[model samples]
Target: MNSNLTVMKSFFLLGFPGLSPKYYRPVSALLFFFYLAIAVGNIFILTFVVCEKSLQKPTYLLFCHLALNDLTFGTLTLPKIISKYWFGDGFISFHGCFTQMFVVHYLGSVTSFMLLAMALDRFIAICFPLRYPVLVTNNTITVLCGFAWFIPLPLMLTIVLHTLTLPFCKSNVIAQCYCDHISITSQACGENINIVLVTALCIAMLCLLVPLAFILFSYIFICVVILKMSNATGRMRTFSTCTSQIFITCLFYLPRCFVYVSNTVGFSFSLDVRILIVLLYSLLPAAVNPIIYCFRTQYIKQHLIKKIKTSRFGIQLNLSFL
Candidate 1:
């Protein structure tokens, strides 16, 4: 542990500023319900993808990685927030805060990379259908998946290492429900941290925005290919395949970009609203990701429907015995 960080002892989270006292209990309940939904939804995606041989393709495998990443991120940040709001337990140890920050950002970057890989898979599958089998073989995809999961760790480790070294003897209140690089970096004052901050910002952009740009280009080329196809049904089918991913991309990226940009440009926002927007983008996707995949992707949908029916039949059969 870095000595500077060890001095923090613990950091307090502000929860949602300006929230009414009367609403705390209700809000805590809502957050707990949200957490449960996220757990169940993502668990369904991860378990079904692994168990069902029909969904063992590259795309579904990517979705499994995504689900696992979401599960990790949500488990790290959400339950802690729930505890903070529900019981006024806002203090997190210095080591704990750093760990949370590392995991949250690490998984965020990995998910972006994983999404990029999935986009590439779609691009090959649709634009070069004949070549897709040759080009995007299972072994090729396995390597790409490995890259997605592993690349972010070392790439972002420098920034996290920089963060862990900064002095933090001042007040320990974090103005949000969790620690992120931005949230924690904003706390360092009195020390000459401007250079460190800028370097970290640059690293964050390189990791996040670069992948986003590639995804955009991949989709743009995909659109051009889809537009040239003569068969409307085939075109629609191809486009539909990308739709869920596109929707998820927008949900995951747009708000994060807005938040980061607004913060960078000194765009004034109330603390409460800023945090609210962050949570919407950060956590909402995990909750909705499985739902979107199951409902949008045909293979997963059919298998999910089958599983539901079988379970329902089992319940009825046991009821008859009773």
Candidate 2:
């Protein structure tokens, strides 16, 4: 350990270093906009699915799970960072930091598995159309989603527990918008820091790569099946159904993989640039997912339009009566 090492009871998040005080309100306003979009979009999806009995199928249920996960993630990380910029409060206790780290990682792992589950659902529907109804029921989807949320708990807990045992004597200044395993572990003071980094990297890659591999395979099979279709119109429609999911999958995985690979290859980004990349990859997908579903999914679009028209007609009727 270095001679300058000192115990750190709390961590300070230095969000966007060198940001002038004048920019604080502007930055907070921008982040609040993103959080609002994420909350409203996801909450709308959740509510719409619950209220629309026609959409209580396996596919929409899976969408609801994804929405719920995104909502939880945005709610978990964004509020504090928003408050920090808005109120000039950025200190976080040791345990609180680790707790945030755990949840961040756990939610990421859940999302990876959730994407895999969705891919599986699509794979079944596209490739085995006859068996899809029997094989991919609501109960089956519930089980898959439940497992996705549950399996990550123990693995992420192990990582967080191991990190908590390491002495954080180097510094408490986290150079990111929020606490994460890499950012937190980078502040540890010990000779075993490299080991911890490698372990964390391996675990993260395992969580990411495993589900990604499955998703890729599933999509490949779906594509092959689509190519074999006899009717061109059916082929185009089936392919269109998958475009939204493919877009979302790419959105979620590509940036994350780039960041991980860049870090592994020793490519360095400045603190502010790195945090911006993290925020974009982490939060952008959540904000955009509802929009994508609303526009791309035929059932959702139809139902949403109908609901809006009905509400408008009801208001018109009330005005006429008055």
Candidate 3:
């Protein structure tokens, strides 16, 4: 350890370096739109599910939690990243950086668990239709959702606490827009044994992969159950219900897994390119979940359509009165 290494008190985000200065505004505007969509879309779906009686099923209840988690993640992460490009305001104080990282990773871990809960919800619904009502209830889901959010807090907190011990006297310019655990930890000024990084990755994969395994396990049995359906119509209908979840899960996990595998294999990419890949996995699900999951759900679809028609009719009547 260099005794004279400058102890950094702050960090700067060097976002999308390859993009010319001339394009920062446009890029910022685009990111702003993404942030807006993520926030508005998720909140809209969350409210719809909560207010609409038909959407009070266990699966939709899980969707509500998922939407709330998405909203939390987008608010905590995307705005700061957007500001980096929008105003060149990339500097963040030490405490601020860690706080952001904690919220980002914590909600992300919660999303993984929520997705697993959704998968199991589907599995039980399809596999044991006769027992579905008793097996899956609002109380059961509420507890699972509670565990999803609660379990990750202390775990992520411990990681962040250990991170606070690392000296970051190195360059404060982070390659990515946000303070990710690995991205921040990589900048620490110490022995750099690499063990810390390895340990962090292992922990992340455990949090991410274990529930992913559960989702896969749920689907395996789900597929088997669907195949055993006596009629073609029933099979197609059952399979249709799983399509939205599987699609969103791929959108959420595939880019992440790609990044992990590429890093493991030393597959090199430019900073801008790699950041884009990381952002894809981080933000895409937030944007897609409302559309794919909400729109595809029959009750939500019908309710939204009905709501739109009534609102339009009210406007038309008001115009006539005018």
Alpha carbon lDDT of each predicted model: 0.85, 0.91, 0.84
Candidate 3 lDDT, tens digit per residue, 104-141? Answer: 88988898888898898888888888999998999999
lDDT, candidate 1, equals 0.85
- Best TM-score among the predictions, by candidate number: 2
Residue 310 Cα positional deviation in candidate 3, in Å, after optimal superposition:
2.2
Model 1, runs deviating above 4 Å: 1-6, 264-266, 310-322
Residues forming the 10-long window of minimal summed lDDT in candidate 1: 1-10
lDDT of 1 by residue, 1-322 (tens): 4366666788888889899978888988998998898899999888888888878887888888888889888899988888877888888988788888888888888888888998899988887889988898768878998998898898678777887778886678888889888788777754557877888778778878899999999999999999999999999988999888887888788888887788789998898998888887889999999888988887788888899999999999999999
Candidate 1 TM-score to native: 0.93
**Per-residue accuracy of model 2 over 243-321 as CA lDDT, tens digit each:** 8789889999999889878999999998889899999999999999999889989899999999999999999999999
Pairs with backbone N, CA or C atoms under 3 Å apart (clashes), candidate 2: none
Better of 2 and 3 by TM-score: 2
In terms of lDDT, model 3 sits at 0.84
Candidate number that wins on TM-score, 1 or 3: 3
Ranking by lDDT: 2, 1, 3
